[model samples]
Target: MCEANAYVRQDGVEELFLEGVDKVVPMDNQLYLENIFGQKKMIAGTIKELSLVDHKIIIEKI
Candidate 1:
C-alpha cells in the first residue's frame, strides 16, 4: 500500500515510467527502481517531486 507510481518528466510533460514501485536505489548516476511485482528498471534522472499522498514520483530525465 506504500508503493508509488513513477513518472519521467520531459519537455514539461510527465510520462508514466513504472507502476507500483516499492524500492528505489541510487547507483552511480542512475536510479534503480523495483516494483512490488519484481519489475525493475534503471533510469538516468533526478527526482523532481514525490507526492506520497498521490502515490506518485516524478523524475527529470538527464
Candidate 2:
C-alpha cells in the first residue's frame, strides 16, 4: 500500500489533508497507522484524502 502525506485537493469540495500514513485506506474499509507506541495504539477511520504523488498516495478517514 502506498503510504504518505497525501494532499486531497477538491475542485468544488472541502480540501483534505493527513500526516504520513501507511495505507490506501479505502473509504468503506479504513486507514490505520502505527509508530513506536505499538500496533494497538493505531488510529482507524474512513479514508478521505485520495491523491497520487509519484506512485505514492496519502489517505485519511472520513
Candidate 3:
C-alpha cells in the first residue's frame, strides 16, 4: 500500500521531503510513500489535480 508523507517547508530552509522512504511509489517524481516501519503519514503537498489509472497516481504539485 502506498501512503502519503508530510513535510514542513520554511523560508530560508531547504529539506528533503522524501528520502529513504520505504513505500516509495517513484514515478513522475510523486511519492506515495511511508515511514521505515510501515506507518502511514499525513498527506503533504498541495494537490491541484489527482488521478488513478493503470496502477499509477498522477498529481499536480502546487
Task: Report, for every candidate in turn, its global Cα lDDT versus the true structure.
Answer: 0.94, 0.41, 0.41
TM-score of 2: 0.32
Error of 2 at 46 (Å): 10
| Local accuracy of candidate 3 as per-residue lDDT tens digits, 1-62 | 44333343445343435433445444444446666666543343443322232222223343
lDDT tens per residue, model 1, 1-62: 99999999999998999999999998887999999999999999889899999999999887
- What TM-score would you give candidate 3 relative to the actual structure? 0.30
The TM-scores, one per candidate, come to 0.95, 0.32, 0.30
Candidate 1 has what TM-score?
0.95
After TM-score superposition, the amount by which residue 57's alpha carbon in candidate 2 deviates from its true location, in angstroms, is 2.1
Clash pairs detected, candidate 2:
6-58, 46-61, 46-62, 47-60, 48-60
Index of the highest-lDDT prediction: 1
Q: Where does candidate 1 stray beyond 4 Å?
A: none
lDDT of 1 at 46: 85
Q: What is the C-alpha RMSD of each candidate to the true structure, in Å?
A: 0.6, 5.7, 9.6
The Cα RMSD of model 3 versus the native structure comes to 9.6
